[model samples]
Target: MISYVSRRLGTSLVLTVLVSMITFFLLSNSFDGVVRSILGTAATSATVQAKKAEMGMDRPVIVQYADWLFHAVRGDFGISYFTGQPVGTAVADHLTVTLSVVVTALLITTAISVVLGVLAASRGGVIDRLAQGASLFGYIVPNLLLAIGLVVVLAVELDWLPATGYTPFTENPGRWAASIVIPVIALTVGGVANLSAQIRGAMIGELRKDYVRTLRTRGLSPGSIVLRHALRNAAGPAFTVLSLEFIGMLGGALIIENVFALPGIGSYSFSAALQGDVPIIMGLSLFGVLFVVGVNLVVDVVNGWLNPKARIQ
Candidate 1:
């Protein structure tokens, strides 16, 4: 298990560095227009050149990347040209909100997918068909549509929730939870649609195995056999699908945040891109890459423990 974790950690670190380097390279190259965005079209060439030199953009690309990486490692991700605030501070400010929504969405998706998947697999007949059909429909709808529709029906029409906004849990837990219902549902529905079907398929395959019948023959309860035995075998593939979903929550949040008027890393990244704020864009990108990799590492450790045979692979 230790070796498995170390291996996964090493791989994750390498991927993070590669992503950082690629992001830095792409951003650095596009920075010719960045100075203009920062200084305006009215600025003279000499002034722009001076600004570049002052900002160290004139340095060798590798050197620039090294310095940026060093500062980023120390939580000093430079200043956003558009916001005039430290890049780290800007991202940090919004990270909590973004994470709150994503984690909530994930928890909802997991609980729902597991139950629906297991039920559909175990029950078969109409339940199985309904679960599959629901999954297909959920997977097909765009999240943007889901957000707008939920807001209109639940928030605007029925007055059941706020139409568009966010309040921190620290301010008011009820309001915060209320504020996120539409967004969480939007994310959860799609995830449940996709993940539950995968779990159902995995579970169905597991249920047919010889050991499942043996457990039944030994007088094991159907629930025990399914939950303790079948679910574990089914979990491996479901977990793989869910990992991609987890990574996607960050990217998905951008659209959901926009439609809901929520302030989050997604909104920040969109603003950064619009303004050509290279530092903020790079900072957010790097942070996202690290977050995805970190989540995958934890998943790997959990998978290793759940199925020790997975460690060798």
Candidate 2:
């Protein structure tokens, strides 16, 4: 386990560094534009030069990356071009909302998918067909379309939830849930569909395996045979699918955040990109990449425990 963790950690570091390098270079292409955004279009040549020098933009791209990486490794991700606050501080402020949305969506998706999938697999008739139909609808529909439809129906027509804006849970729990409900549902639709299909298939396969029959013959109840024996075996791959869906949710949150006007990383990232706030953009982008990588590592660790054959050398 130690060896596996060490290897994954090393790989994650290498991948993160490479991603940071690429992000730096890509942002460098707009280095001049960022300066313009900072100083505005009317600045004199001397002013531009001074501003560039002040922000250390005059350095070679390689040196700037090294400096940024060094600071980043030390938890100093630099100051935002627009906010003027530390980039880490700015992200930290909005991180809570984004995390809350994704985490809520993940739990909801998991609960619904597992219930539907297991029921479909065990029953394998009308329930199975209904589950499949729902899965297809969710898997195929575009998130933007669904989000808009939801906002219009739930917020405009039904008058149950707000269409836009956010309410921090700390301030008002009921309002917080009301505000986030639409966006979370929109973000998790595909996740629920995909995960349910995976779980259904995994459970069916596990049910067909010889061990299931042995357990059944051993006088275990049907629910126990399925839930205890079949579900546990099915969970490893379902969990992997869920983790990948989580990464998808993170990416999807960007769009949902914008759609709902929530003050989360998605909104923050979109604004930063529009204004060419290099520090904020870099910080948000790297945060997302690392988040995905971290989730995958956790999944790998879990899989190793579940299936010992997957253990690292």
Best by lDDT: 2
**lDDT by candidate, in order shown:** 0.89, 0.91
Residue-level lDDT tens digits of model 2 in 1-313: 8888888889998998899899989999887778887888998888888988998999999999999989898998988777779998899988988989999999999999999999999999999999999999998999999999999999999999899999999999999999999988997888889999999999999999999889888899999998988999899999999999888988888899999999998898889999999888889989988998899899988988777788844
- Reference-based TM-score, model 2: 0.97
Poorest stretch of ten by lDDT in candidate 1:
23-32
- Misplaced by over 4 Å in model 2 are none
The candidate that achieves the highest TM-score relative to the unseen native structure: 2
The CA lDDT at 238 in model 2 is 96
Model 1 RMSD to the real structure? Answer: 1.8
Report lDDT (Cα) of residue 146, candidate 2: 97
TM-score of each: 0.93, 0.97
Candidate 1, residue 274: Cα displacement in angstroms equals: 1.2
